[model samples]
Target chain A: MNNIILKVENISKQYRLGLVGTGTISHDLNRWWHRVRGKEDPFLKVGAVNDRSAATKENYVWALRDINFEVQQGEVLGIIGKNGAGKSTLLKILSKVTSPTTGEIKTKGRIASLLEVGTGFHPELTGKENIYLNGAILGMTKAEIKQKEQEIVEFSGCQMYIDTPVKRYSSGMRVRLAFAVAAFLEPDILVVDEVLAVGDAEFQKKAIGKMKDISRGDGRTVLFVSHDMGAIQSLCDRLIVLKNGYVDFSGDIPGGINHYLKISELGSSMNYANVATDFGIEKVTFLDKDRQEVNSVMVGQKLVIRVDYKNFDKRNLSLSIGFLDNFSNFKFACRSDVLDVTYKDNIGVAYMTIDKWPLSEGSYHYNLAVHESSVMLQNIKEAGSFRVEKGDFYGTGKLPGKRGSFYIEYQWE
Target chain B: MNTKHKDEWLYTISSKRKLIDFNFKEIWRYKDLLFLFVKRDIVTVYKQTVLGPLWYLIQPLFTSVIFTLVFNNLGNIGTGGVPPFLFNLAGITAWNYFKECLTKTSSTFTTNKGIFGKVYFPRVVMPLSITISNLLKFGIQLGIFLGFYCFYFFQGTEANMNQHMLLFPVYVLMMALLGLGLGMIISALTTKYRDLSILVGFAVQLLMYLSAVPYPISEAREKFPSKVALIVEYNPLTQITEGFRYMFLDTGTFTWFGFFYTLIISIALFLIGLVIFNRTEKSFIDTV
Candidate 1:
């Protein structure tokens, strides 16, 4: 077994809710006085847990609380959570960009975090100069950057404009250059926070390939935080799921991913409100052909989406529904005009059914929109979501698992 | 993968804020970052400007002429027999270094919020770079002052260059330390109380008058009341500037007691600044 490279014990961060200047001084003084008298901080006990959904009377909230974990050398750990889950806070603390409010982290080697790409790049500086500056900011020595300078430029594919100022480069080129500098950083422990969310599809593939090489070839530990479940499932050896500033799950990749998906389904299901009160969508729900409200369906089962609307006005209104993969990439879309459906009712439900769904096993979200002859009335992205389980589609007792987003009919010669 | 061998260092970060945890070795290890930051500050400042580094010479030159017009011609402030232009240039050159360092470093957290929010480095590297970069500007301004000094000296004016001039480096170091110290203190405090940032510019300008930059302390002592004279005399920067004039131009009140007092005060302020800066750097990102 590889040795444990990092240990985080009971790390918690408490932040004041509002303007900290006026009230903070008194708290600072009170804490100082109590420390002088050898007493525990009286305010430390008064903070509420970081539950963004709930209203609280206390002025202080813990963004992270009692977070404990350990990482073995060469292990890729994925942290997954919904928004306000404190994942970024934990990464910030681990990166030493900010200190924890309580608890300790023990580490053995250097940690380089790409909390953001192009973090310290100056727009006026040339790409070459920014490579050096950003590399140094990411904890690479000057000599080391010089050694990798050629490789970084080549990898970024911006060698033609290495001496040109970054401000002159396209946004895609900038992200590529920034990612190249960070990818060359050879720290023992690497912490990446959604850096792969940048660049085009080709560059993202290249970036993920590079990360995999870094983790596998050098036997370095990697802490990756991303909302892209497909990438997380493929890249991580283990996972930690955070919810409301607490560790909701920590185990193997599938277990943690399952827990996270379950929580997300629960969270998103509640958001099925009438988002736009004026000529708006009232609710969206997912069900099976049996008309039962199903949280998920087998890949080949009949999947139905029911979108309820209000204030329709019966004015030649058309509705469109789109299916998106976990990364929010649209897989397919269907419009009511194509189906030759017209709604005359002011408030009613429109159901879009897909017989023998062609999607592979993964989580997907539905986006709904209503338009009156092209003038958009209501558009709700990610109105509801459902999971697709593995099922045989080709009448062979086999299914495509984590291969791609969909299934296509084929004939074997 | 040797289980029997333990790592050389174990870093533990807790909520407990230590009073003084300045890691000099870590700063040393990141010295390359410090150098690059200094280079960035110097190179980027004059990139698109027409006059470029020439602005360095122009700033002190114009300020000296203005001082000659207002402080010398109008206010009748004596320069102790040294030409008013030369005297004003000398004081401005020295004060400019300290002022630049103080104001730039004072906004470290606010100005570098983008960088500090993303990555981890020795936070002191930023202020250290400002001090170094400002020192370069100070050097250029000093060179101009020397050019003017040579013209006055060749004209056979009563310009005195004494053996004490060898202590110029010491004076520069003292000014840098004092500026860095005060800058760090203000920067740390300004992270939470943003109003202090607004006060820094005005306060530094007022401090310049108090430090006798445009007027010598001896003249201020003769002109002002006794209480005001005592305040000007006790100002640490006043002694530093006065000693600088005594060394370079060889005419000003140069007392061993004043030198020692300024030395003690600058060192004390530096230590206090370090303590507070160290404490603030850990979590200032949250507030800033």
Candidate 2:
């Protein structure tokens, strides 16, 4: 009976879009009247899906619709999504911070939500006082907090400033103390919403260890939401991807992550006709050494790039391709002049070949340029991107974790 | 709807809830949170201030003095043949408590939208905590009133203290309930229509005049028209203020009918406020 600790049944939340003003009350009035008459809520028939980017003539959107899931005892489930994907909304509903518009969620035990660290923290309260207050806000009784006060203080490393008001603690120390209190919560189910995104790296490690302990050791269930793929890969046994407020994918960690990777990848081929110069690139295609087009390739594999151009004005211009990381920061560039290649013709093609692509396991975007004698002709940034999966870079099948966006070939004696 | 899992599940969260489910057990479970919130309010209010707790006494004292100067001396309003200063002091002391509970609790949702959005607890804990927290301030203000009460008693004036003083605690309870109840109603309404919150500050101030805080009910009856006098008589806060003046200075009218009428109304408003408050708390975060 206790095997399934939580069951979410057909949970959905409909939200009225735009400003909540006069029209909102009229809709509320209409819904109430319908409810009194034993009719379904008219707004429940909203057709628009929740897409924050688009404009809508309709007044309503379904933030979450018929979301169904269950958590077994001691299982860690990760909810991965982009911004406004209703991750926070689902967590809020599960923790009873808000109620779902339709259906229900049945849970067997206590649910503690860490939507944010230090909920109800008063800056004027001393660190020790805030610990008790924060713990109580998280549904802990006074006696329970008192018993764990010493351990919480030690974990926070804020023993010296226990009596000092939290207003004086540095932002980092405050997060430490808040997270420390959170770590001690003995709830049967914990709902975390990107709370691990804060705090230092070492503290985050400790917090993650504590979360693992809470779920694995104590047999409590956890529903975690985070954008960090590594944390999801390490902590969650199961994963669900939410896109536009719907469950787009759900499965084992690696499978869900791969599905997420594919969904998040952008176009691999792009045309440059509109941005063409006198001697400009017409198109760019990412390919393997076999000349087969691909959007993703293994690490340390040969990557061949083909650039088709139209040298209408017949200018002596050299082609260039620059690889950029996620932030659009240039890591390295490939210039045609490296091989003393320059072109001045009616139309032509260019290529950049790397025997071993050195970028680490991550998605990389690239830019294109055509220049003549230090005078830039056409520079198109963020032209296209491709993904690189992990591979056995060395002969040994061992790989160090991601330190940066590079894997250069080197040797030592 | 199924019977097998219904009883086994410890909690069920859904869109529809009982209209009058106060969930007192949940509030009781969060008693520690309630206590800490009360402590935080009381302690943080006076922090880094030079006067600190003295400001509690000074607030009513200064208000009483101002009322004495403006309403009694300048406007020539008599205080039942007793010293106008003490009479005004008594009314202001009780008025401050009611106003404090009302103004602070009326904005519970707006003031606490941050914590409420991020966490789940009985939302009533906030207003209940405010009501309890303001008690400490009211207690101190009562102490100051009593200090003056003894000073005048020894002076051997016509301010006769009576057995009506036995109802003092009852009067304090009614004030808190009325303030807290009205505040809950307004705050709940404000979660959707925020214009209601903007009206609370000035509304409470204007209400003090109608509640007979600066002057006694007897004066309002004698000076104003019968309809306006009826309005003052029917105001619930008028009963508590008159009860306090009667207890401390023996200078205001207090009838059993008016007293219980206000009491019944306070209890009714409180229950109604609780229902609205409970309904709003369940889903206010969406609108707020």
Candidate 3:
């Protein structure tokens, strides 16, 4: 039997930019007129969901556009996107918090959404009372709430303060209680929207583990949204990459991650040249093995970054490059400041290059700093990044973790 | 995994209406939430008030005092031989229930929009819970009204508080239905313009004046023998308020014509309110 629980087809949600109310009265009237005439909503037809950053003639933009997907019973679908990529809007539609402007969605079973923790918690109510209140809000019966009350309290670890009002409880305590109620209630369709962003690292880890147990152990469909790619890769069986409100990629987890990383890297480079204006440097390039400018270079190749500076004062000029790992950790820094070189020539021009990048098969960023060894002049943190594509030169080597910044070949015989 | 079992489950409850309309069964299953909502409203309403629950009685007591002073002393408003305090107290008790229910029910959507947006239950359960919770306040006020009734009766005062007072509960029920109906309509409307919200206070005040709260229907009836008295008596709340005064004080006249008129209007408004409220709950988040 086909166990399709949710089927969404060409779902699109259009939102007028800016204030939602009286500010859009005239536009609303025009929309009403177009609606009455049985024409396409004039605003929706011309606006593209993917053109959020691009200048448009109309003020309306589709927060979500042409989204299509189906979730089978007991499938955990991860939604990953950058800020303002319409992940929340899509989840809101799926959870029925809002409706789609166009297209239809057919869903089975009741949906329970933890759009935000403590969503319905009355601050004046006691912790125990709020658990029952929140449970009821999540559609649990009184008997069900009573039975789970102890478990919920135990999970929240706020048993001593059970009688205290939630307003007095700390934010972490509030989140724990809220998440406890939502998780314990066990709705058939659970829609979690970046709720893991709350609490300390330990609590986030526990919450993620709890979510994994909920999806894996229970036969409930889950839609998890987060900007944390590691969490998405770990918990989601399938991933959907949203770019400007449209599904840029949707498939198995690894492929989706690859596409998402590529899109994000391209986005960083699109504004790369604009970012180099502060420095008196005219050009910055990522050079590969054969001395060619490329964004992605093969692993274990001669990765050289050439920078051209404008001043002839080598005494006052210094160039530095920093290597950032895949998770955006700064692995190490190489600087010309360490070298005792001075440029006191008549012509004000100099070039410096790094040989043999020594990084593995993953993404790395290099930043350039041009100034006196003692006085800092210009520092571009994220100057540029290039992907180290998998290569056969070192054969297929395993990294320390399941996936990390780079794959370093170690001779451990 | 079994196709036969899947088909059987599908065929058993495949009616289109069951899918389109809200499943009241699911709401009934969530009766705990309904009870919690009611409990929250009741417990939190008088949390920080000076007298807490005693504030419920202060309204009718104060209103009774003012009525006894102004109407009996200054305006010479007759109470048909009933003590002005008892007459006014009974009217105020019944009027308080109507007014509270109307105000509470109407603000259900606006007041609870935060909760409503987060969760899904029978949205009707919210207004229903408000209508139920406001009863606690009304119940306390009614007890105070009854205390005065008993005191005056024992004092050999001719307030006429007797066996016919059993019908008081019926009057209370009608007032509740009337308030719920009107409140639901306004609650649904407030989600859009919010203009109705500001007017609700004035509307409640005006409704109190139109109802025979400080004055007995009998005196109004005697003054305007023909048309105006007929119209005043025909007012649904007026009849219900006057019915309470008639049952206890025996001052106002009661008729099946006026009672049935109120009964029909109350039920009609309630049903209309329910239909509109249900529709509004589904999409009010958009406007709200």
Top of the candidates by TM-score: 3
Name model 2 segments beyond 4 Å from true: A265-413, B1-7
Query: Per-candidate DockQ versus the true complex?
Result: 0.53, 0.51, 0.39
How close is every model to the real structure, measured as TM-score?
A: 0.85, 0.86, 0.88
Per-residue lDDT over A1-413 for candidate 1, one digit per residue giving the tens place of the 0 to 100 score: 64888989999998999787777888899998998999998888989889888999998999999999999889999999989999999999999989997898888878889887887999889999999999988888899999999999999999899999999999889989999999999988999999888789989889988989989988888999998887897789999999999999999986687678768744346226665475767777777898888777787778787878777666767889878876678999889977778665777888888888888876777788887777877787887776678887887897756657788777889
The sequence of per-residue lDDT tens digits that candidate 2 reaches over residues A1-413 is: 54788899999998878788958777878989999999988888875787877788888888998898888888999998878888989999998888999989988888998887876789999999999999999999999999999999999989999999999988889889998998899988899888877788998888889888988898888999998887887789899998888888888886687566556635343333344355478877777889997767678889888888885366667889888865457899998866688877677777778888888876667788888878778888877666778877775887778676678788889
Tens digit per residue, CA lDDT, model 2, B172-194: 89989988999999999999998
**lDDT (Cα, 0-100) at A334 in candidate 1:** 86
lDDT scores in order = 0.87, 0.86, 0.76
Q: Give the clashing residue pairs of candidate 3, or none.
A: A314-A343
- Tell me which of candidates 2 and 3 scores higher on TM-score: 3
Taking the candidates one at a time, how many backbone clashes does each contain?
Answer: 0, 0, 1
Ranking by DockQ: 1, 2, 3
True contacts kept of each: 0.79, 0.82, 0.38
lDDT, candidate 3, at B251: 78
